[model samples]
Target chain A: MGDVEETVADVGEFALIRRITGGRPKGAATLLGPGDDAAVLAAPDGRVVACTDVLVEGVHFRFDWSPPTQVGSKAAAVNLADIAAMGATPTGLLVGLACPSTTPASVVDELSAGLAAEAARARVGVVGGDMARSDTFVISVTALGSLDGRAPVTRSGAMPGDVVAVAGKLGWSAAGLAVLGRGFRSPVTVVGAHRVPAPPYAAGPSAALAGATSMIDVSDGLLADLAHIAEASTVAIDLVGGLIPVDQRLIEVASALGADARHWVLTGGEDHALAATFPSASSVPPEFRVIGSVTRGAGVTIDGKAYTGDPGWQHWR
Target chain B: MGDVEETVADVGEFALIRRITGGRPKGAATLLGPGDDAAVLAAPDGRVVACTDVLVEGVHFRFDWSPPTQVGSKAAAVNLADIAAMGATPTGLLVGLACPSTTPASVVDELSAGLAAEAARARVGVVGGDMARSDTFVISVTALGSLDGRAPVTRSGAMPGDVVAVAGKLGWSAAGLAVLGRGFRSPVTVVGAHRVPAPPYAAGPSAALAGATSMIDVSDGLLADLAHIAEASTVAIDLVGGLIPVDQRLIEVASALGADARHWVLTGGEDHALAATFPSASSVPPEFRVIGSVTRGAGVTIDGKAYTGDPGWQHWR
Candidate 1:
C-alpha cells in the first residue's frame, strides 16, 4: 500500500471514523458529539425536526463533475434545506456513508471535510455518523432542527389568494448542469452553484415569523415542487413568467450554451431555493421576492395557462 | 411490460414514497409524520439522542439468507439499540433507502413493512424517509430518542471496583450465523436470531436509574465492546470465565455444529445485548446478571489473564 494511496479498508473502520470526525468543532446545539453510543442534541422547543436524503453516485452526482468535498456539501445541503423548508433551523446532522473497500481513503477524508464545510455554513456540525463497505458510493444524511416554538410551515397550509414567493437563486444549478453536460466548464460561479447550493436557511424561519402560509424547498424543480404545494393545499398557483428571477449570470451562461435560461429557472431542480406562500404582499419577508399567487383551482400554471415544455427533459425526476 | 411485476422505477420515486409511508400508524412521539419536508417528533426532555447505521446488501445481509423484512428490521434494530444504549427511549426513525431501478416494488414494500414492524416493536414510528436509485441496495436508518430527563449512560464513566453485568442473550446470533454458514437451516430459533436482534431497550434506563456508571451495546462482540468501555473509562475489566452465561440452547446448537459455545458468547457480534458497569453487585438490576468486575489497570482480560483464541476468525471486523 506504500504511496499507492491507502484505501478505506487499509485505514480500518474505527480509524476511518476518527479521521472523519476528529477535530471537527460542534455547535452549541450539540450536547454530546461523536465517540459515544449516540449523539445528544439540544431540541430547545421540545420538538425535533428530522428528515433523511440519500445520494447515489452516478444517479445523483458524478465525481468528475463535482469533487468529493462539493458532493459532500450537496448531500448535507439537501437535507439541511429540508429542515429549513419546515421553518426550522438545523441543530445537527448524521451521515451514513457506504463505499467500496477499495475506495481511496482520501475520498472519505475530502467528503467528510465537505460535509463539515456545509454543516459549518449552516451553523451546525456533523454530530454523529456511520461508515460501511459497499459496492457503490452512497451518502445518506439526516438533519435535525428546532422549530423554536413556531408551527411548521407544511405544504398544505397555503390558501386561495396567497402570494407565492421565493428566496435564493432559482436556476443557476440547472444552467451549470447544462454547461457541464455540454463538456465545457467555465463561468466558475455557475458551475460552483450547481455543485454547491447556498440555500437561504434563515429565510425559512423568517418567513414563518412573517406569517408564511406554506413553504417548500425547490428540489424537484420550481413547477414540480410548486405543483406539490398546489395539490396539497387544494389550490392552484400561477407564476408570472417575468417575475421569476433569472440571474443575469445564468442568462449569459445559458446563451453561451444555447439553452433557455427561463426554462431552466422554471423546471430545473437542485437549487434548493425556499419557496413559500404569504397571505399578503406586506407579510412577505425581505429576502423573498414575490413570484406567483394561489387561487381556488388545481395544478400549477404560467400566468393564466399551462406552459408545456419538453417532458422527457425533466432531469430531476 | 405485460405480465411483468412492477419495479420501483415503474412506480416512480414519489409514488414509491407514498407506498412506503401511506397508512402507517404514527406513534405518539411523531408530532408530524411523512409527506412533509421534515418530520417533527416530541423530545420531551428538551434533548434528543441520535445515531445512524448503514446496512449494505451483500456486506451486512444477504437476501438469500434473510428476507427483506428481517433485513429491514435488522437495520432499524441496530440504530435503535444505539439510542437505547444511551439510556434513551427511541421516539422516531428516518430511513434512507437506495436500490437498483430494476428492483421489484414488492421488495421495497415488504422491507418497509419489516421496518414498520420493528419500529412498532419499539413503540415508535417511521416518521420519514427518502428513496433513490442506486447500483447497490442500501438501508440507512437514523433513530432519535428521548432521555426523559435521565442522565445519558456513557461508556466513559466506569470506575474501579465497579461490577460488570449484562442483559439479553449472547452468542445466539453467532450460533445462528454458524448454523447458516453450514447451509443447515433446520433450527429456526438460531437462524431467526441471526436475522433479527431483540435488544433490551428498557434495561438501559433501568441500569442508569440503578446508578450504573457506564454502558455499551454489544455490537462488535463481547470482548471488543467491553474493551470500548475499558478504554473510554481508563480502567481495566476482568470477566470471570465461569460466571459467563452461555444459554443452554446455544450450547446445544454449538455442540451439534461442533463449535465452542463459550467462544461464541465471548466473541459473537450483533446480539445487541446491553453490557453495563454498576457501582456494586447489589446495584445490578434484576434484568442484568453480574459477570465480572472492574479494576485499576488497562485493557480487558478473562479470569485475570488475556485470553487469546483463533485470530482471523473475526467475522465482523
Candidate 2:
C-alpha cells in the first residue's frame, strides 16, 4: 500500500480533470462536448432519454480492490445500461467527479481514458460534466440517449404470456468477484471479468425493434431485476433454471471453489445484462436467449420456487 | 452532535429513500418518478438540456451550520439554475444521494422536503434517483430542461459591443456565508439568503426571448463567471461596478462588519444569478438590468481595471 506515493488530495481537482479530459475523442452526436458551461448533443429524433447514478468509493468500489480505469469504465457503462434499458440508443454522457485535491493526476487521466474507451465502445459521446472536491472519491454520471423514432419500452408494458429473455452473459461478474475475494490472482479471465463488464450494447435497441414490451438492465441480479418488471407491470415472472445459460468459465470456477453456479447466475449483480419481455409472436434477437415467460402473478420465481440463497444487492440494505 | 441520537447507518439506505420520496408531488412531465429502474420525463419540445453537479458535506456544506432543508433546496436549485442558464425551461430533476448508514431519518426527511420545496419553486418535477451508503453525505443532481423551440443561448455567442446584464441578486449569498463563518447570527435576511438562494428562474428563458447572445448562471463570482463567457466568445467583458445593482443591505452588512462591499460583490459566489450579453439593438428583458458591456479584448475587467481581488470559489482549491 505504501508503494502509492501520493493520494487524490495531492494532485488537485481542476488539474486532474484537465488531465482526464485532454485529448479524448468525442463522437459526432456530441455537437459540443465537455469544457463548457453545459454541453449540447444532437437529438436527431427530437427526444432524449436521461438517467443518473452516483458511485461512491468504499461503498460502491474500493480503490484497493478496483483500478482507476475499471472504476471509470464501470461508471459510464452502468449509466449507459440504464439508457439502453429504456430501449433507446445512448447519444451522450455527463459525468460529475468528486475527489480529494491530492489524488494522482495519472489516476484521473486513466479514469477519463476508461470513460472515453467505454464511450467509444458503446458508440456514445461524453458531452459534459463537472468536477468538485470531496474527502471520499465519488463519480456521478448522467447519461443522455436518443430514442431514434422507437417507442420507449417502459417497465409497465409487460403482459401475461410475454416471453422473458436476456441479452449478455450472466453470473460471470459475480463469479469473478468470488475469485477476487478469495485472493485468487492466477485466473486472468476471472480477474478480468471482475474488473470490467461488457454490457450488451446493441441488444437494448434490438430488443425494442423486436417489439419488447418491457425491459430493464440486470445490474442487481436476475431475480431482483425481473421482480421490478413484475411489480411494475403487475404480472408474474417465471424463469426456468434449465433454460438459463451460464458462462462455462464461471461454472468451472464456481465448481472448483465449491460454490453454486446457479446461485451466482440467479442472484449475482452488476453484469449490466438486459432483460426484456416480448410478445410470443416476436422473434428474439440474436443476442437474446429466451428463458422464461410472464404470467398472472405478483412476483418472480425461479424454477417454480422462490430463491433462498440471497435476494440480491440492495443499495439501502 | 450526540443529541442527534442517530447516524446515517442506523437508518439504512433504502428505507430512508422510500421515506424521502413518499407523497411528494411529481409534476406532469414525469412519466415515472422513483421506484423504477429509471424515471422517465416528458420532453414535449423534443430536446433536453441536461447538466449535473455534486455537493459533499464539509466540502460543499456543513450539516451543523446549515439546515437539512437548506441543503436539499440548494442542491436542486443550483442544478435547475444551470438548465435555466441554457435558456431552457427545466422539466424534471433526478438526485443521487449518498449518506452514511448512521444518518438520522429526520435529516433525510428534511433533505427530501427541501428538494421538493425547491423543485416546486423552480417549477420542475423531481423524478426518480439513486440512494446509496457513504461515509459522508453527498448530493448529486441531474437537471433536464426543454428548449421550447428556442435556440439555446450558449456562452460562445457574445459579440463586440454587446450589453452585459444580470437578473437576480449577488453578494447576498456571500454575505450570508460571512455571517455563518463568523457566527454572527444577526440579520435573518442574510441568513435566509445563504441558506436558500432565489435564482432568477424565469430570467433565463426571458433573456433568450429578448435575443440575448450568450448567458450563464453566476455560480462562481461575477468577475470569474464573466471570464468564462469572455474566453468562450473571445471577447472582453468590461463591468461598470457602479451599475451593478447590489442590495444596499449587503453594503450595510459589509460596513458594519468592516468588510469590503465591492469585494463581496466581485468575489462572492453561489448567487445563481443569470448573466448574459445582448446585442446593442436587442431589447433588454425587463427582468434583467444592464451592468456592463462586451468589447474586443480578453478576460473580464471592472471599471477598465483588472479585478485582482480573488477569482472566485473553485472546487478543490
Candidate 3:
C-alpha cells in the first residue's frame, strides 16, 4: 500500500495550517510569521519590492505530470524570479492555495514543504498564507523583496551600445516539456527542469551591482522578454546565435523529439534565466556570458535578422 | 446592443493589463507602481504588514447574485481588513486574477475599476497584478501596510482584565445573506453589506494609539475570532449580550427571514469589524464601544453561558 493520508476535510482549515507552519524556521526579515492577522516583514532599506503570480491547474500544471511538490516549487520559483528580475533580494512569501476538499493531507504537507524549501534556498521565509476549497487546484504566490538601497535596474535603462548577457541555462524547460508531450524517454535532468525550474536567484542583484543597464527574467521566451526590454528601453537588441549557450541535455531531448534545438533555445520559456544589458562586455560578471549587443532601433533580432517562428507563450492564446 | 465589448482573447494578456492599469492614480507609498516586473512600496517604519486572501467564483460569490464590481470590492475589503487588524496603515495591493479565455474585456475592466476604487478609499494603490486563463474565476489579493513606527497589536497580547470592544457594525452581512437566500425584499443597506462590507479602516490605528492590548478583524464571527484571541492569549473572554451592537436594518432582515438576529450577531462572519481588548472601557476610543471583558480562564462565553450554535464558517466543511 502507498503512504496513508487523510483528506483536508478530516483535519479542517486551522489544523491544516498549523500542520503546514508548525516547525518552519523563519528568516530575520520575517519579524512576525503566521498565526497573526498579518505577518510583519522587516524592510531595512525603507522600500519593498513586491510581485505576484498565479498557477491554475490543467493550464499551468497537470497532476499526472507534476507532483504537488513540483507545483509548489514552480509557483515559488516564478514569483521569486520576478523579484530577482527587479534586482531585489527576496525576503518573504505569501501563498494563497485553493484545492478540492478531498485532496490528501499529505499533498498539502508536501506542497508546503516544497515552498518552504525553495524559499529557504533564497534565504527568504514563508510569512503568511490563505487557503480555500475549490473545484480545481490553484497556487498563487506573492513575493516581497528588498532592494538594499540600490537603484532598481529597470528594463527602460538599456541604451544603444549596451552588451546583452545571460546568467543561467535556457531552453531546458521547453525542451523538457516537448519531450514529455511526445512520450520520449529522456534524461531526468531535462524532464525535471519542466516540472520545477531552478532560477538564477542571486544573479539579479549581482547584475545590478555590476552596473547592469537593464534586466529581465526569461519567463516568456528569450526573444519575447527581450522585446519588452527593447520596447521599454527604446533600443533594438541583436543576439548572436553561436554565443547563446545551449545545454547538451536539451539538445538531446530536442533531437529525440525531432524538433529544432535552435528554436527551443531562442523561443523556449519558463527557464527563468536572468538576461541583462551592460555598457560594455567587460563589465559583465564571470557568471554571465555575453550573448549579443543593443543597437539603435526597435524590437529584438537574431544575427541581424528578424525571428520568423512563433514568438512565445501567450496565456490567452 | 448593450455595450459592445471585446473578449480577453481579442485583446491578449499584455493589452488587457494595460487596459486595467492605465491612468490609475498612485498613492504616496507607491514608489513604482504597475508596468515593471515588480512594484516598489515604501515601508518607512522598517516593517511591512502582509496578508493574502483568495475568493473562488461559486464559493465566495456568485455572478448571478453579485456583480463583478462587488466581487472586486469584497476581495479588496477582506484583505485590507487584515492589514487594519494589525494596526497598520495599508499602502499597496497586488492582485492575481484567473478567468476563462472567453471572459469579456469589459468584465476585467470593471473588476479593476472596483479594486482601484476600494483601494483609493483607504489611500492605498493597486500596484501590480498577474492574470491567467482558467475555467472558473478566481481573485487573489495581497495587501502591504506600514506600521508608521507604532507597535503592531497582536492577538496574544490580551491581559486578563482587558475590556473587549468593537469599532464597526456586525451581523448585517449574515442577516443579509439569510434575507437574500429567503428571497425577502430587504433594505439595500442590509443586502449591500453582504455584497461589499464597509470595514472601519481608520479605527485600527486609533485603537492602537489608545493602547489596545490585542486586536482582530471579525471575519469568522465574534465568538470564533475571540476564541482565537482567548486561545492565543490563554485567557477566558466573557462577552455581554446587551452591549453587542445590532443594526436596525439587520434586525428587520433577520425578522423577515424568521431568523434570530442575536444568533446572527454572535455567529456571523465577513463583517470585517475591528474587535479589540483594551486595559479599560475608558481607554477605548470614541469610535469603539465596549462589548465585554477578558478574564482568567480559557474559551469564550456569552454573559458567562457557553454558546451551543455552529461555531462559525468553516471553509472545508
Candidate 4:
C-alpha cells in the first residue's frame, strides 16, 4: 500500500518487523510485547501450556494454492488448538518466519495481517518472534496458554466406560483437502475449511470443566488421534459410526468425488476438533456430541469392529 | 542406538519424533511431557517470558562449518537468551525441526541430544515439538521462562548517567568465527567457543536484582544492540574503550589474522552476553564489567567518535 517499491531485503529484518507491528493492538495479558528480546505474558494461573507447529512450503502448503494470509492464520490456529486441547485459555503467540529475500514485502504484510486477525479472534497477542532468510517459505508458530488453575486434561486420564465426545466438526477439512486436491471449482465452504480451520477455541476449557477424562486435538485424523488416547490410557476406544457429526458439504463433495464420506470422517485430520472422554453417567456439555466410548482393550475400533482401511496422515510420507 | 537404520523419511515424521523423545529424561518442571497436544510448565510467578527463533540452513549456519550439535545448541541458546534477557528463568523449550526426508535418524537423535544438553545447562526442560519434511534443514525453537513475580527489566528503563556494563565474555564468538573462517585448526577452544557459546545465564536475573536500569542480550553487535537500548530508553550510549573486558584468546587470534580485537569486542555479536545499565554509584556485580555510560542523546558512540566499520552482522546478506 505504499507508493515506493522496496523489498524485505532493502528494509532489513528489524525494520520490517517494526513496520509490521506498528499500530497493532496488544491485549491486556501482554505485559511486555514484541520489541523486547522476549515477551512477558500474564499467566494468571501459575502455569503455562505451550505448543509449537511448523509449516513448510510445498511440503505443507503451496503459496500459489493458499493465500499468505490464510497460511498465516492456519499456522497460528493449529498451535493455538494444541494449547486449547490442554484445557488452557489462550494468552500469546510467538512466530518464526523464514522466507527468501526475494519474497514480496506485500506477502509478508498480508501474512502479518492474517496472523493478527487470527490472534485477535482467539483473544491472544502476537508477543515476539524472529525472522530469517531461507530458500523456501516456512512459518513456525508457538502458542502459549494459561491453565486458569485447573488441572491439565491429559490423554492418559481416560478410563474404561468413559463416554467419548467431540466438540467441533470433523471430516470437513479432509473433504476440503480432497476437493482442493482434485481442483474442484464449486463448493467454496469445503475449500475454505481446508485453507483455514475453525477450531472450537472455547470448547477445550469447557470440556475440562465438564469433567473430561482424557482429551486431544484432532490433528492426525479422528482414529489416529484417538489411538493416541487409547495408547496413553491403555484402553480400547469404540466409536459409533452414526454419531460422527459431519458437514453436509463434505458428504456432497465426497459423493461427487466418488470417495467414502466415512473414510474422510474417520481418517481425515487437521480439523483440530477437541475429542475427550467423560464419565458415562456425567452430563455432556452442550457444545459436545457423544461420538464414542472407552472400553477395556488396547486399541481403537469403530462400532466394535477393527478398521482395516488407511491409517491416517503421516507427516513425511 | 537401535538396529534400525531408518532415515527420517523411512520412519516418517511422527514416528521419528516418537523415537527421538521416547527415553529422554524430562525435567521436573514438565508436569505434562511430550506425548500430549501441549506441554504444561510450572510458571510459579503467574507470568512467562516467551520467544521464538528460527535458524535456517546457509542463512543462519552452515552444516559443513557447524556440527549438528552446535546448530542445535545455538538454536536453543539464542531462544533461551531471550527469556534470560527479560529477567526470567527459563523453564521449558519447544522445538520444531524441518529437514529433508533423506536425513539420517542418527543426525536427528544427535541434534535432539544437543538440544537436551543445552536445555539442561539452562536449567530448562525440552518439553515438546513438531517435525516435518522440507528441502532444507531449519530449526525453530520457542523458549518459556518464569519471571518469579519480579518486574521484567526492559530496554526502555535506562536513564542518564547509568553505567553500561556487560556480563560474560565478549568477542570470543566472533573471534572464533574468524578462526574458523581462516581455517585455523590448532586451537580447539576458539573453535569450541564459536560453535557453542558460554553465556552467563544467571547474570540476567542477577542484574535485575541489582536494580538494572535496562537490559538486553548481545545477540547483535555491541554497538548495534546498544543502539536498541538507546532507542528504547531515549538515551545515548558512550562506550569507554579502556574498560571492555575481552578474552585474551580474541587478541591472539585477531593479532594473528591482522584483525582488530577492539572491533570484534565492540561489534562482533552472538556472544549472548547480558548487557545492562546500572546506577553509576552502585556496586557493580561480580559477573559484570562496566564498559560505558548512558547519556542524554541518541544512538551509540565509541569514546566520543562514531564508528566507521561494519555496523554488524546482516541476515542473509
Candidate 5:
C-alpha cells in the first residue's frame, strides 16, 4: 500500500467510483459505460444471457491466502464461466462491491485492475457497478453475454449414447486447495490455480457451434456436476476411470500429501472446466477429451458400476 | 419465526435456491428463467440498459426497523428506479443474496416474495440469482431495461432555458426518517415511505416520450441531484421557492419532529422521484409539476439566489 493511499471513507462514494471507472477502456458491445445512471449494452441478437455470483470474505476467499487481485480475478472467472457454460460469448459485466470503510483505496484499485484484465481475456468489459460500505468484504458480479444468434446449449439436451467430454483442466483447483491447506507455497502453478482459476473461455461457444447436446461448467466436483446433468437430461452417465486425465503435478502433490489423486479428480469443484455431451466421439473437438458416455439410466457411474464416494462441493453443509 | 421453519444450513444452498425460484411466473422478456447456467432475456430493441445497487445490513437497513420483506422491496426499488431514470422499460432483475447460516429459510422466502411484488410493479421479473452464507445480510440487485428504440435521456442533455419539473413525492422519505429517528411509530404513511419508497415508475418513459431534455432520479436531494445534471450539462438550475410543492403530511410530520421541512424537501434523499427538464413549460407533461428552470451558469440557485445548506446524502461520509 502507498503512504498516500486513502481509506474508502476519506474518499466519498462518488469520487471513489469516478476514480475506479474514469479512463477504463470499453469493448465493442459497451454502447454506454459507467457514470450514467445505467450502462447500455448492444444485444444485436435480440437476446442476452445473464448470470450473477457472490463471493463473501472467509467463505469464498481469504485475504491472507489470496491477494486482492486474485480475489477479483476469481470472482470474475466464476461468473464468466457461467456465461460460457450457457454457450454464450460474454459481452459485459456489472460488479457490486461492499467492504469496510477502513479498507485502503489501493486495494480496490487492484481489484478493479484484476477484473478489467480478466474481462479483457474473456472479450468483455466492466461497464457498470455499485459500491457500498460493509463490515466485511462482499463481491457480487453479474455477467452479460450474447449468443450471437446460436441456440443456447442447456444441460437438459443430452441424449443416450452421447459422448461426454471436458475442456480445460480438472481437479487443479481442488488439488491446489489441498496444497494450500498443507502450507506448501512451492509448486506455484498448483497454488495459483486455487487462487485464480483459468477457465477455457472459448470452448463453450465452440462446443455449441460443433453441436454439443448439453453442457455445464465444473464448479462442483465432476460427479456432482454430472449428477445435475443426469438429473436434468434424464440420462445416466458412465465415466471410464482410465480415460480420466490426471495432471502429473496433481499426482505428485497428492502423493506427497498422502491424498488420493483420483478423489480430487472425481470430486474437485471450482476448476470451471467445460463439460459437454456430443453425439459421437469424433464430433468432440480436439480441445475437449472424451472421458465418459451418456447412458439410458439415472445418476452417474464409473465403468458401468456404482462407485460410492464423496460427492462434489455443497455450501452450508 | 415458526418452530418448524428450517435454518438455511438445514435446507442447504441448492435446495434453498430451488425453493426460492421454483414455479414462479416469468415476464415476457424472460426468454429462459433460472435453473440453468444462465438466464436469457429478450431485448428486442437491440440494446439493454443495466445497473446495479447493493444494500448491506446495519449499513443500509436495520432489522429492528425493517422486516425481511421490506428490505427486499427497498433493494428492488432502488435498482428499478435507476433503470427508470434511464428512460427505459425494466424487463428483468438478477439478485445476489448473502446471509448468515442461522437465518431461517422462511425469511428468505418472504424476501423473495417482496422482490417478486416489486418486480411485478415495475413490469419485470427476477430471472436469476446467487445465494451464499455470510455473517451479515447483503442484497445486490441488478436491473435490466430496454429503451424500445428510443434514445436514452442522459443527465448531460439539459440545456439553458429548459423547464425543470418533478413527478413524484419529495421530502416524505426524509420526514419519515426523522420520525423514525425520533422513535415515533404512528403516522403509518410516513414510516412506510421510509421503509419502501413508491417511485414514479411511469413518469420516466413518459417524460422521455414528452421530449424531456435531461432526467435523473432523486436518490439524493433535489438540489444535490440537480447539481449533477448542472455539472454534467454545464448549466445552472434555479428553483422557484413558491412553486415548489410541499406535501402537507410531510409538513405535519416535520413540525411534530421539530425539524425544518424545507431542508428535508431540498436535501433529503431516497425518494426515487423522477426529475427532468423540458424544452419549454408547455411541453411539460400533466404528471409533472414545474419546480425550476435551467440557466447559463454553474451550481444551483433558489429564487435566483444560492441557498447554502447540507448538500445531501453521501455514502461513507
Candidate 6:
C-alpha cells in the first residue's frame, strides 16, 4: 500500500486537540494552558490589551500561493501586531479555527507549527483554541497583552507639531504580492516576505517609553493609516517625498514590473510596520526614522500636495 | 425604489463597525472599548482568565430555527460559559465576525444587539471586534475574566471522597432540538433554551468560594463531560438516578414526541450547566444539588451501571 494520509476526520476532535497542544512549550505568562476549559495568563500591569483578527480562505489567502504554515504564522503575526500597536507586550493567543473535515491532518499540523513558531518568537504561547467544521476555512486569532505599566499611546494623541516616524520594513509584502500576481516567484526574499511578516514587536513599548504621542499598525497602507490618525486626532500630516525611504530592493522589483516604487511605499498594505508620533525628532527611537510631521490642516499630504496614488489593500473594502 | 435593504458592502467596513459598536454600553472592566487598535480591560487580580469558542452558520445554528439575535447571544453565552467554568468572573469579550458581503446590515445590527444584551446581563461589554467578508458566517468570541484572588478549580482536582453536584438547567436544549426536528415550535421555552442558554454565571465563583475541588461547563452532555473530569482527575463518579432531575417541561415534550426524557437528561448537550465536586454535601452551595459521588475508578456510572443511551450533539463530530 502507498503511504496512507490521514484526515482530521480519521483522528476525531479530542485527539486532534491533544496532538495540537501536547508538548508545546509554554510562555512566561501562561499560568494555565490548553486542555482545560480556560487559560490563565499574567496581566502584570493590572490591565490587559486585547484584539482580534480573522482570516478567510479564498478571500484572505490561497493555498497555491502560500503553505498552511505561513498562513498560520501570518494569522498570529497580524493579531499580535495589534497588541504591539497599543504599546503593550503580548502574553498569549487564542485561535478559533473552522475548516472542512476532509482537510489533511498534515495541513493542520503544519499550520499549528507555524503558529507556535511565531508565538515563540514573540515570547508568548498559543494558550488556548477551538476547532470546528465548516465549508469555508476560517482562522480567528485573539491576542492578549500586558502593557507593563506604560500608558497606551492612542491614535488620538498626535499633536499638530508631532514628528511621524516608522519602525520596520515597509511595502515589502505589497511588492511580493505584485511579484506573485505576475506569476513569478524567483525572488525568494520578496516571495517569502509575502508569505510571512516580521512585525517590529518591541519598538511599540520602546516608543511609548520615549513619549510617543500616537501610534498605529500600518496594515491598511501608510497613507491610509496616517489618515486614520489624522481623523482621530483631528490634525493633519505632511510627508516629504525625499524623507520617505523606498528600499533599493523594492525599487528594483518595481522597475522590473513597470510599477511606481514611491506609490507602493506610500500606499501598500500588510507589511505590518509600526508608525508612531514622537514629540520631537530627538525623541524618536533608533528603530524609527522621521518621515513627516503632524500639521495643522485636515488629512495626510505629500509635502504640500495630496498623494493621488491608488489606495492599495485597505482591507475588507 | 422600494426602500433599498442595506447590505454590509453598501454600509462599508468602517461604517458597519461603527453601527455595531457606536453608543453601546461599556462594562465595569472596560478601560478602553472599540475604535482603538486594541481594547484595554481591568484584570484586577494580577492575572486574567481567557477562552475562545467558534460558531459556524450551518454547523452550529440555523437562521430558520433561531433568529439572528439568539445566534449572537448564543455565541456570547458559550464563550462566557468557558470563563465561568474556570471559577472566574468575565470582564469583557472580543469578537471576530466573518460573513458574506451580501449579508444584511440589519442582521448584523440585530446580532450585535443580541451580543450587547447578553453582555449587559453578564455585567461585561463587547469591548472590541473585527469584521470580515466570507461566504460562510462565523462568530468567534474570546472571553477574558478575573479570579479575584481565588485559585482556579481545574478538572483534575476531583478526589475520591468528593461530593458531585450540578447547577442550572440540563437536557432543555436537547429537548428543544428534538422538538424543532419534529417540525414543532409551540414550546417556546425549550426552543429558546436551544437558542440562548442562561448559564449560571455567578454560581461558578460561588462554587470555588465554597471550596469546590473541580468544575466544568457541560456543553457536551452530562456523562461525556463528566468523563472528562473523571479522566483528568483519574477517578470515577457514580450518579444516583433518583437524584437526577428531569424537568416537567422536558417530560411533557418527550411524552408527546414518544422520546425518552431520561436519555435526554443523561446525554443531552448545550444546556451549559455548571458541575462541580465538593469535599462534602454540606459544602455544596445552594445553587447546586448533590447528584453523585466521586469513586476510585476511571469512568462515569449512572446508579453504578454504564449508561448505554445515545450521546446527542457532540460538537465538531
lDDT per residue as tens, model 3, A101-174: 89998899988888888888889888888888888788899999999999888889999999999988789888
Q: Any runs in candidate 2 off by more than 4 Å, and if so which?
A: A1-15, A18-22, B1-15, B19-22
Give the alpha-carbon lDDT of every model.
Answer: 0.90, 0.82, 0.88, 0.85, 0.89, 0.89
DockQ of candidate 5 (2 decimals): 0.88
Q: If you superpose only chain B onto the true chain B, what TM-score does each candidate give? A: 0.97, 0.96, 0.97, 0.95, 0.97, 0.98
Fnat score for model 5: 0.88
User: Candidates' DockQ values?
Assistant: 0.70, 0.54, 0.87, 0.83, 0.88, 0.79
Name every residue pair that clashes in candidate 5. Answer: none
> What lDDT tens digits, residue by residue, belong to model 3 across residues B77-111?
99999999999989999999888898988888888
Model 6 has an lDDT value of 0.89
Q: What tens digits encode model 4's per-residue C-alpha lDDT throughout B1-317? A: 58867789887787767654556667767777787898888888788889888989887677778888887888888888888887788899899988988888878887888888898899777888899888878899999988787889899999998999998778878888888788775478877777777788898888888888899999888888899999999999999877877677778888899998888888888888889999874656788888899999999998988999898887846
Model 5 deviation from the true structure expressed as Cα RMSD, one decimal place: 1.6
What DockQ does candidate 1 have relative to the true complex?
0.70
The alpha-carbon root-mean-square deviation between model 1 and the true structure, to one decimal in Å, is 1.5
TM-score of each: 0.98, 0.94, 0.98, 0.97, 0.98, 0.98
Give the Cα error of residue A235 in candidate 2, in Å.
2.2
Clashing residue pairs found in predicted model 1: none
Estimate, for each residue in B1-317, the C-alpha lDDT of model 6 and write its tens digit.
37978889888887777766667789999998989889999999889999999999988889899999999999999888888888899999888889999898999999989988888888999988888888889999999999999999899999999999999999998899999999888699999999899999999999999999999999889888899999999999999999999999999999999998888888888889999999999999999999999999999998899998876465556
Model 2 residue A264 CA deviation in Å: 0.7
Candidate ordering by DockQ (highest first): 5, 3, 4, 6, 1, 2
Which of the two candidates, 1 or 2, achieves a greater lDDT against the reference? 1
- Candidate 4 per-residue lDDT, tens place, A118-214, comes to 8888888788878898887888899999889899999999999899999887887888788878977458877777778889989999988888888
Ten contiguous residues with the weakest lDDT in model 4 chain A:
A16-25
Q: Which ranges in model 3 have alpha carbons more than 4 Å from their true place?
A: A1-5, B1-5
State chain A's TM-score for model 2.
0.94
Model 3's DockQ score = 0.87
Docking class of 3: high
Candidate 6 chain B, poorest ten consecutive residues by summed lDDT: B308-317
